[model samples]
Target chain A: MKNNFRNSKLLVIEDNSDHRFFIEKAMKTCLSEVSAIHMSTEQQAIAYMDSCLYQEWDLPTLILLDLYLPNRENGWRILEHIRQMPTPINQIPIVMLSYSNQRDDIAEAYQKGISSYLVKPTHEEEWVSYFQKLRSYWWETVTLPKMRFSF
Target chain B: MKNNFRNSKLLVIEDNSDHRFFIEKAMKTCLSEVSAIHMSTEQQAIAYMDSCLYQEWDLPTLILLDLYLPNRENGWRILEHIRQMPTPINQIPIVMLSYSNQRDDIAEAYQKGISSYLVKPTHEEEWVSYFQKLRSYWWETVTLPKMRFSF
Candidate 1:
């Protein structure tokens, strides 16, 4: 499984510290060689992407972004910030995270070019199971873009 | 599981007769309520999208497109065609299917705005496993856009 995800990376942009820690740990449980970069704010997330571009290091293969707004229209602003980037950076797959199951929210995310919409789980165990399913589907079944090292 | 995929739909665009049949069967094995629309040519695929728009029936939630060209340059033309469409239609997730594991192929697909790239498995059993993982990841974990009834 490690060989399958060779050169692959993940970027998680969430404001909540507990969620940021919980997500990173859950992902590690599913994939042994996990090393996810965490960004607590939208600004930090954007800066990380820019740093990747400027440093010549490869971008993360997947991005998990949390919806930030109190109202229904969450994640769009941050998604737009990332989408406004240049070239391949803008093309990276982003999975938008939210706490709602409303059709309108999913519809809006789809319209905004979000790769996938994920509802935050209620319990911690569900997070592990979620990452396991994600591991099998995304890491094993899917072919991701090539990654290059800075060195 | 049936309720999870309530109004969701799938479009499979593959030239090979066996693979098209195989993918549909494999998907059905995992998801009890499976109804996949198959198209043999790029034109047929495009027409289906147009028909969905004209009829006001929502488009498929996911699309599995085969890489046609013998060289690495495949699936881009069909991808471009779909992307040229307006609104949510163009933003629908399209997974590129191929038999190659080359990084270049995956990179190109990502660059072309493909949601994901999947390498077609060799054995028949692998196909079933692939669909099962797909079911778990896409159907259960991901919150797909709401589907509409034509009537």
Candidate 2:
């Protein structure tokens, strides 16, 4: 895939250090022009989103969301807020990248209007290949709505 | 995947005999419980759908729609009619499976609310694998809206 054609950014929200490192390492070979921003806490993610809104920055094209968080609000709440946001922020494609295998979680996420739900692959190669295909389709093939809000 | 689940049907509307055979063969390995119904002409497909409605039978779970059909009305017109249908047929997932590589076709199909757009892979093995994944995700894994009315 042509790297220049898809320069969309990705945000990864996870609390685990090992998982963060694994994602970073695996993404190197899988996707082209992917820049991932990570946060260890749900508060941090909310704060980051707040800052982005204040600064009027373009939202990431895709978000890899984890269901669990450090404290207080969880990923589902965050997703709900994002979906309810005005204008461009509401249009960003958010995919649940969680280890939770519960059918209810999957069902609930889809019901809440999640773009996609993927169980975190166990192996590094599997993770890489999965994200590669995901990036290729979401960024290159899919006509994603713009995510920059204007007053 | 367990093959004991409620069997979902697939109606593939395609004009090419080879392509129909290819899809049927591929679907057999991946979707054992799925009953695939294929039609080479628009008249036959419409007739089948109408007959299902007339007999008060449940419609197919999903449709692998081909854009080019041998009839007066094109695929889009059929799709529009399906969307306008009164009962269970209105809610069926219609994933467009087409050979058209044109960007306009892709854009228009999605704009018309296609569940998914899949390009026909050139390689046989790749086609099989791709269709397997499609079957798993779209047919077996995803829980579609319940059929409200038969026909």
Candidate 3:
């Protein structure tokens, strides 16, 4: 049976303008009906989340997080804060998008309850395909609990 | 840069003959060149694993496991035994495949270090699609360290 829902919405937390633009272009080119909210700073991401809560919009289904950012604290700290949030928001899947594939990075992400750890690809086509495959599999196939279904 | 390896070898640890046959057929149809092995008993599975070690073949990329089996003990007990084994085989990814979607079941599976918890789908297509997508995303697209690579 064909899935009725459009591709899942995503929140991308990355500091680099070029990388963010590339990812947005890739998603638009590959996945269907996926909208992304990109934030360059941790403060901006937190502000957007607060606004989402205030406006009562459903939180994004997946978060693509870059471990390194222009901000002082970095992405893991943001993930920690989001995980501490009361409900509805805490359940969103956060996948780490990082350049480092160090064992420590993988171990720490798993320890912090990140859904998945991915090493960013060097090639543009590979990167695009990564998100395309992610969309096709995770958003289209997996039966994740909707925001309304969350506590 | 498309991934060269598009399929994964999977081991399904379950005792029910009907369910095993259903899953086997599903994998054969939905997956491309996937090697699927089904073991009905823990003793048989462990025995097969021992034989595989002598053959110098790599461990299956993912394990789909049922929590309950015909054996007197639970699957978690078998998982505990696997975790204690030395390197090489100890690192295989185990995905808990079960009909139980209870919160406690999910929590316990994660606690015991299951790679993922999949609630067995009622429909055949959904079941086929679930395993196919998992193989595509986790095994094909993601970078899983070989047993020899883990430090």
Q: Give the TM-score of candidate 2 (chain A).
A: 0.86
Top lDDT prediction, candidate number: 1
Q: Model 3, A1-151: lDDT tens per residue?
A: 2241444478899888778877987888876476787887888888777776755454776788888775325777887877776555666667788877766565566556566667888877777889877876656654343464333
lDDT of 1 by residue, B62-120 (tens): 88888874333335777887878776577678888888777767777876777778889
Interface RMSD over true interface Cα atoms for each candidate: 1.8, 5.5, 4.3
RMSD of each: 3.0, 6.7, 5.3
Order of the predicted models by TM-score, top scorer first: 1, 3, 2
Ranking by DockQ: 1, 3, 2
User: Using lDDT as the measure, what is the rank order of every candidate, best first?
Assistant: 1, 3, 2
Give the per-residue Cα lDDT of candidate 2 at A70: 53
- In order, the Cα lDDT scores of the candidates are 0.74, 0.66, 0.68
**Local error of candidate 2 at residue B58 (angstroms):** 6.7
Better of 1 and 3 by DockQ: 1
Give the C-alpha lDDT of model 2. 0.66
Which lDDT tens digits does candidate 3 get at residues B1-151?
2231434467789987777877887777776576887787888777776765665354666677888775325687767766555554655656677776666665556556555556787876677777677767776676553544222
Model 2 misplaced stretches (Cα beyond 4 Å):
A1-5, A54-57, A70-73, A147-151, B1-151
C-alpha RMSD in Å of predicted model 2 compared with the true structure:
6.7
Would you give me the overall lDDT of model 1?
A: 0.74
Task: Give residue B81's error in model 1 in angstroms.
Answer: 3.0
Residue A35's lDDT in candidate 1:
60
**In candidate 3, what fraction of native interface contacts survive?**
0.18
DockQ scores of the candidates = 0.68, 0.12, 0.23
